[model samples]
Target: MSKRILITGAAGFLGSHLCDKFIAEGYEVLGMDNLITGDLKNIEHLFGNENFVFHHHDVTNFVHVPGQLDYILHFASPASPIDYLKIPIQTLKVGSLGTHNLLGLAKEKNARILIASTSEVYGDPLVHPQTEEYYGNVNTIGPRGVYDEAKRFQESITMAYHRFHGLETRIVRIFNTYGPRMRLNDGRVIPAFIGQALRGEDLTVFGDGSQTRSFCYVDDQVDGIYRLLLSDYSDPVNIGNPHEITIKDFAEEIIKLTATDQKVIYKPLPKDDPMQRQPNITRAKEILGWEPKVDRAEGMKITYEYFKSLTPEELNKKDHKDFSKHIRK
Candidate 1:
């Protein structure tokens, strides 16, 4: 019998790709998502695979998976600013309550669990090129606090389980990752710029666009996560590209790639937005022997092609997901 694993948020961009990766690796994969921010279309292609099973359930509530489970990847959460700001309570619950439930399940099944953390935990860092040991500077009451605090709390609780219960746990502090299956209007930089260019609209750059970010292709991110899961390191590992670029330069690159005759527009930066986000991946290279292999030009080209393939209806649709039913009272 093949090893069995459960992946939450499996219908989301990264989760869906993970589903494909695990299935290709010959694992019996179980995918769960609430569709709050996750679209089933991302994972619909895997519905026919005999090794794949999907559960349309919310992990913030009870998560029950029968049979022997070898591993669990806890990835259920609203990752973007737009999604988390709209559903703050749900976002908090998924990271806190949802993580607690999954931790309990992992302990029960004796399964090793990996939590998906983000660069948001670093907030607007005072440190350059964030390292694993750098304590973050975050505004607990800021608008972005809902997501950042949730992830910070998730990491805390995950460590508690690892130390107290002796449960096997892995944490991946993912950085800016982009690739196919990304929602065109998801409020992420890569997709947002691409969407504007594709529509022949001016690219929107916030706060003079000096803010910097590093992009890691989804394949590289997944590969690092896979290696981390299998490695013996139990502490948090940063899985992202260290190469950084400013927003203004990135916008110019996007404009050139799309060949759109549009200019760049400036807007006020949002509250608590990170000014610089470059990961220090020395730990990843030394421990996991991993570093992002995809260059920005190649990765951006692939991402642009993915966005260009979207239908006119999808491109124009402001909000593709309906959160009415998922919003809890």
Candidate 2:
């Protein structure tokens, strides 16, 4: 029999790519997503494959999977600022409640699990080129705190489970990742700029656009995650490209790539936005023998083509959700 694995957030951008990766490797892949931020269209191509099965359920509730399970990748969360800011409580629940439930499930099945953490944990870092050893600088009560604190709590609980229950766990601190299947209006920088350029609007840059970010192509990010899952190291591993670029320079690159006549526009920076985000990938290279293979220019070209292929409706669509029903007082 083939190895069986469960991946939550399977309909989202990174999760959907993971589903494709494991399925291509001949594993029995179980995909679960609440579809709050995940779109089915991303994973629709896999429905015909006998090796892939999707469960449309929220991980915050009890997760039930029948038969043998070999691995679990806990990736269910509202990742973007637009989504989490709109539904703060749900963001908290998935990282706390959702991670707890998945860890429990992993223990029950004797499966090795991986939890997805993010660079947000290092909010507006005082340290340049963040490392795993560096404790982050974050505002617990700030607007971006909803996502950052939840991920911090996630890493805490995951480690606790590893120590107390002896559950096999892996933690990946992912940096800024971008590619196709990204929601154009999800409030992430890549998609935001691309969408504006496509719509013939001036590219919007917040805070004079000097803030720096490193981009990891989706393929490279997935490769690193796959390598980490199979490795013996259980501590957090940073998976991202280390090549950094400023927002202003990146915007000009996009304008040139798209050949758009629109000029760049500026706005005030959001509260607690990280001014610098470059990953210290020495751990990843030494441990997984991995470093990003795709450069920004090549990766951005592929990503831009994917966005240009979208229909006019999808291009203009905003991913706003009615979270009032899900929000608690």
lDDT for each residue of candidate 2 in 230-302, tens digit (9 for 90 to 100): 9999999999999999999999999999999989999999999999999999999999999999998899999
Query: Residues 31-143, candidate 1, lDDT per residue (tens digit)?
Result: 99988899999998998999999999989888899889999999999888888888888999999999999999999999999999998889899998999898899999999
Error of 1 at 329 (Å): 6.4
Off by over 4 Å in 1: none
Checking candidate 2 for backbone clashes, the offending pairs are none
Who wins the lDDT comparison? Answer: 2
Q: What TM-score fits each model?
A: 0.99, 0.98
For model 2, what is the error of residue 185's alpha carbon versus the real structure, in angstroms, after optimal superposition? 0.7
C-alpha-based local distance difference test score of model 1: 0.93
Q: 41, model 2: CA deviation in Å?
A: 0.1
